[model samples]
Target: MSKLIIPLAIGAALLGAPAIPLPSGAGGGALQARELPAYLQCVPYAREVSGVRIFGDAHTWWSQASSRYERGNRPRVGAVMAFRPHRKMKLGHVAAVSKVIDSRTVLLDHANWSPINGRRGQIERDVKAIDVSPGNDWSEVRVWYAPLQALGKTRWPVHGFIYGDGAPAARPRVVSPPTHVAVTRAPSRQFASAFDAIRGGASPAGYRQAKPLPPQRGYRQAKPLVPQQQESQRKSQGQRTGAQARDPIAQVLARYD
Candidate 1:
């Protein structure tokens, strides 16, 4: 069983939002209130995608004395958690949540979450969120290299799963394929090359100009030709010659005889 950390001071520091009072007589062994700011900052993204509003301290398990795992056991949709080693820096870590899409698999979000200059605030993304876990919360979550920046922008499909008893078993139906309707798509190698060329500012005169088109006529009269001219042209034709050579009267006489 993973040990849970429930720090009390962090719960006291929450400003506008009222703290969630833990259930009385709820097996109070140890409680470590989680920090509000970092967890609260992730709430908007969670709410937008998962439809659940996270309030109060984010609950996590202490896998070891120095290390804490934010998401474990009771995995819920849109819940974000951190994974820190037992005796390491605060920011060199991974963050993700349980995506309840189905009964079989779940999605994860993690990135190059190393601390910049030993500060808790500095973090960046070499981040990807594409891990799948079985339908049990206790099962270890597998991290995927695929990261999702926007909810619907990948060629691959997005899905999630739930674990444990009485959990819903239906898979999330895909409403539509991921679309790119943004003014500019995410930067690619071609865009980078074009940007580099423009920055170099080497203008050549090899550019071509467009050509002009001819004016159009509103209407035109059909040309009239003699019927004899058309007949004369077909006079030497093989099909017409073969048809003319067949004797219709001889065929009728042969049939009668």
Candidate 2:
């Protein structure tokens, strides 16, 4: 739910050849996306480690970087993929390319798409994203989910990849976008108790962590009762005894039947 406000650094955008090269034999691996190690979140990680200067909704990245940075329709390692708006993704999404798994699949690092510890804003590194588009132009794609440990069903839009190595130009031409769009990973609680219910055999955390019961009265460790509680118990017992004394038939039934 954050907006991307990027600085148009003139001399840093990727123009022609990329500065960071792709790994050898990258595209030959499995087609599915994978999850990265644990971390704080995407926004800071993208800005701190990946060196993405832009700040806004992930979808607005293309427009914000269009002026000072270069944009493209391909996927490359260290390049940021700026996604266009789509269903529920009104603002869009951005991810750093970690590896190229053939022309149809690529591994990435991003945040907030996967729920971690009842949180939505945590970071997910080295996750897989597949280009679902049949045109092979890198238009439509499906990203990996962290909590579910699988590829999500949502087909996201792509503006293109924005490499950090591009040379900076003049001041960026600011293209203001609409309101921020929120992205949801799975459903509320990921469709289970804590989203952990379905993932962990449906044993709810609440049930598993329930408080222990009090000891019985005959037990040595039975909790001591307060004066008020003792008084109430005595009054109830006294009433029962008085009723029994008043009825000989009740006493006979108790002694025999």
Candidate 3:
């Protein structure tokens, strides 16, 4: 019986080149690449670290947290802003309050916003965002874009803010003392414009007609608001607090009040 001996060889040359051992999951290619940074998405990440108890996408947070947490349209540091759907964001977006610069400007920390390294689901920290709403209501805003390093043009509408158990920054807001003036009309000082007091320090009964007050940054009024919008606000307020629903943001506006 003649037995033929067969030689078995296993080496880097088997793959046509020196086989550089790779991690098990590394995909085979002429150019090996490392895995991208693994970062969390917006909604889940916000919920996880926000200390707020709410669920669903960013758009649903405000309505869901209305009863349990302090919800309002004003931005306070540490609140989660629930963006509304618009031309750009169809599923909506959520960002945590990192800093309140002023009444109409804030810095937000969010994930999956700016595309980095040509990848989605990235994190943007301490990005500047500004309120562009006509009412200065914190409803419409523009967020900073990392690639451009500038504020984006896409206007984003927001449902409002959800406040949790978080401390605010050292931002000092001059919340004009709650005025006994008609609730319909914000205090003259609170709504000062570019014009000044008439001839002297006397403001005409009609501020619009009087010399306007020098315009102050982060200070604006929801003037020229249509009757329909006013009526809608009132009606909506009535629905939220029941008999006391006449004021919806009582808990929220308390800071400013």
Q: After superposition, how far is residue 13 of candidate 2 from its true place, in Å?
A: 29
lDDT of 3 by residue, 29-129 (tens): 32232223344568876776577878777777777776788777788777898898777677788899888877767889898899988887877888888
Model 1 has an lDDT value of: 0.38
Off by over 4 Å in 1: 1-40, 60-138, 144-167, 171-257
Whole-model Cα lDDT per candidate?
0.38, 0.65, 0.69
> How do the residues 120-150 of candidate 2 rate in per-residue lDDT, one tens digit apiece?
6677778877766756567877778766777
Q: What is the lDDT of candidate 3?
A: 0.69
lDDT sort, best first: 3, 2, 1
Window of ten residues with lowest summed lDDT in model 2: 1-10
- Per-candidate TM equals 0.23, 0.47, 0.50
